[model samples]
Target: MWKGLIKTNRQKEFFKKAERIAEEACKHLTKTDREASFSYETLKVIKDVKYPSMSLAKSEGGEGLSLYELLLMQEKIAEGDGAAALSIGWHMGIMMELSQEQLWDKAAYDRLVKQVVTDQKVVNRAATEPATGSPTRGGVPETKAVKQGDQYRLNGRKSFTSMAEHLDFYIVSAYVEDKDTVGWFLIDRHQAGLSIDKTWDTLGMRGTASDDLVMNDVKVNEGDLVELKSEGKPNAKGWLLHIPACYLGIAVAARNDAIAFAKDFQPNSLNTPIAEVAHIQDKIGEMEWKLMQAHSFLYSTAKKWDEEPEQRGLMGSELAAVKLAVTNTANEVVDLAMRIAGGRGLSKKYPFEKYYRDVRAGLHNPPMDDAVIAMLAKQAISKD
Candidate 1:
C-alpha cells in the first residue's frame, strides 16, 4: 500500500534501521509489560539509533524526515513495544511541531533542540490536570504562572504525564496571572520545586510510566514561556497519526501470533491443525480485513499530508477521521485475534492478553472517537 512512500534512498535506510531497532526491542516487550516498568534499556537503543531526532530538520541537527516517514517508523517501533512507541512518539511529535512551526521563543526552543540532538534528552507536554480532564475541551487550567520580576513562579499539578520519569523538560500549560491568558511554560526536571509522583499503575500500556507532575512555586525565566492564541484553536496536528499507527502495529502483532498458533496447534480430536478449520479461517479472515482497512486509511492520510501542504490547513476533520477509523479497527482486529486464540489468548504465557489491553488505550488517545464524530457532524451540517 505504501510502495513509493519512501521516495529517497536516505528514507529507505532510515526505515530499515527503524525495523532493526524494533526487532531488537520486541525481544523484551513481554518482560517490560509484565513488570509495568519503563524500558530504559530500550530507550538507550532508541537514543543510540537517533530515532527521536529523525523528524527534526537537518538544519536543526536531525535526519530531516517527513511526517509520513516518521509515522512509518513509529508503527514499526510499536510493533515491537506499544508503550515504548507511545512514549517516544510524544518526544518525536513535539520536536516535529516545534521545527515546522517555530511555535516557541527561538532561543529557548534552540536550547531544547540542542539538548535533544547532543544528549538525546526526552520531553513531553504536561497539560492534563486534576481539575481539567482534557485540555482540548477548553477549560481554564488550575496551574498558574505568576510573574515575579524577571522570572515566573509556577504552581500546579499535572496528571497522566507520559514518560514522566525520563523527561528532561516538560512543556507545562498554565494560566498567566498577570496577562489572564493561558500559556506554555518550559520547566526543567531538575528545577527546585518540580517532582514526579509514582502514580502510573494501569491495565494497559503500563510501560509508559505516566505519572503526576507537581510544581510548587517553581521559578522559570521569562524566556521559558510560549504564548498561544486566546481562542485556543490548535493548528492542524498531522503528527497525531502516530497514535493510530501505534495501535495498528499492536493489532498486527496480535494477528500474526494468532495465525502462527492456528497453523501449529493440533489435537487428537482433529487430524489436521486448527488452521484448516473453517471457523478459525473465518475469524482470521475478518482480522486481516480490518487490519488492511486500517493500514490503507492510515498510510493514505499520511501520504496526503506529506504531498499536499496546502490541504493540511483543512485536514483537521480528515486527520481525526483517520484516527477514528484506524483505532476502532485496530481494537476490532485485536478482539478477533483473541477470539481465534481462545483460552490461550487469556493466558499470561502468551502476549495476546497484553495486546488486548494495550489496544484499548487507543480509545483514550487524543482526537477521541466521540469528538471526531461531533466534528464530522458539524462539518457536514455546515456544508449542507
Candidate 2:
C-alpha cells in the first residue's frame, strides 16, 4: 500500500474501508469507461457501505470525519474510479460544509441530516446554469423563483448537475424577483416539472452523468427556500479541496500502474525489466517528486482548515492555490506515467489512457486555473 497520512484510528479504519471499495470498483472501471455509463450499482455499493455519512456531524449520529480525512478517502476512491469519486464527493463535501458552517436553517438542515444518516440519502447543489456558467463566477442565476402563498414556484435549467440520476435532494439556486436576490431551494427529486436532460456526454469523467437539470415551474414550500443571497464573493469553502484530492488520486493510480508495468515488462532488447532503464527510472522519479509536492500542498491546506477554525475564513487564497497547484501537478504526474507506459499506455487494454483523460478534466473544475491565477495576482499586488 502507498504511504498515507491518516490522523486518527477512526480515520484509519475508514480509509481501509475506502481502499476496499476502490479495489472492488476497479473491477468495473474499464467496462464503465468504455461505455461512458453511469453506475448506480457502484453508487449502491458506496451507499451500502454508508460512506456518505462519514462526513456528517458526530452530534448527528455520524463519524464527522475531518476535512483532511474526507479528502484522503476521496483520493483513495478516485484511484479506482474518477467519476465515482467526483460523483459522491459533491455529497460528502456539501455535508461537511453544512455541518461546519451551519449555514442552513435548523429545520431544513435537521430534516436532511437525519435522512443522510438514517437513509444514506445524497444531496448536491444545482448552482451552475446554461446561461450563467459557474455560480462562483458571480453570475446571477437565470432560474427565478416567485413567492406564491407560502410556496415558491421555480423555473430554469441547471447544467453540469453531476449524479443527477440519484440525488435525493437538490439545493437549487435561483433569483427571487421580489427580494431582488438569489435564494436556495431544497427541491425533492419527485417534484413535478423537475427532470434530468441526459446531456452530460463528455470526453472524460463520463460516468458522472453530469446531465442538465430541467426545472419548469417547479414549486416548493416556503420552508424549502433555505438561504438568501449574498453580495460579492462567497466565503472560503475548504470542502472544495476534494477536487484536487480526487485528481491527485487519479495521478497516483497512473503512477502505480506504470511502475507495475515497468517492473514486469522485459523488452526483447533489454537484458532486464524496463524498470531498470534509466529513462523509465527518470520518469518514475519525476512522478514521485510531483506527487509528493501535490500531496504536501493539498493535505497541508486541508489540515490547516480542520485544525484552525479561526484561520478558516482567511484560507481563500490558500484553497485556490492548492487546487491550482495540485491539479496541474496531477496532470504532469499522469503524463509522465503515460510516458513510462509507452505505446501500450494508449491501448484500451491499459488504464493510463483513461487516467490521462480524466486528470485533464480536473483543470476544468471549480476555482478554475485562470481564476486562481488572477486571484493570486490580485492578492500579491495588494500586498505590495
The top-ranked prediction according to lDDT is 2
Clashing residue pairs in candidate 2 are none
lDDT of 2 by residue, 227-344 (tens): 9986666789999999998999999999999999999999899899999999999999999888988898888888898889899878999999999999999999999988998899
Model 1 segments more than 4 A misplaced: 1-8, 229-233
Candidate 2 stretches greater than 4 Å from native? none
TM-score of each: 0.96, 0.97
RMSD of 2: 1.4
lDDT per residue as tens, model 1, 340-383:
88999999988899999999999999888899999999999999
Model 1 poorest 10 in a row by lDDT:
1-10
Clashing pairs in 1: none
Q: Candidate 2 at residue 7, lDDT?
A: 56
**Model 2 alpha-carbon miss at residue 340, Å:** 1.1
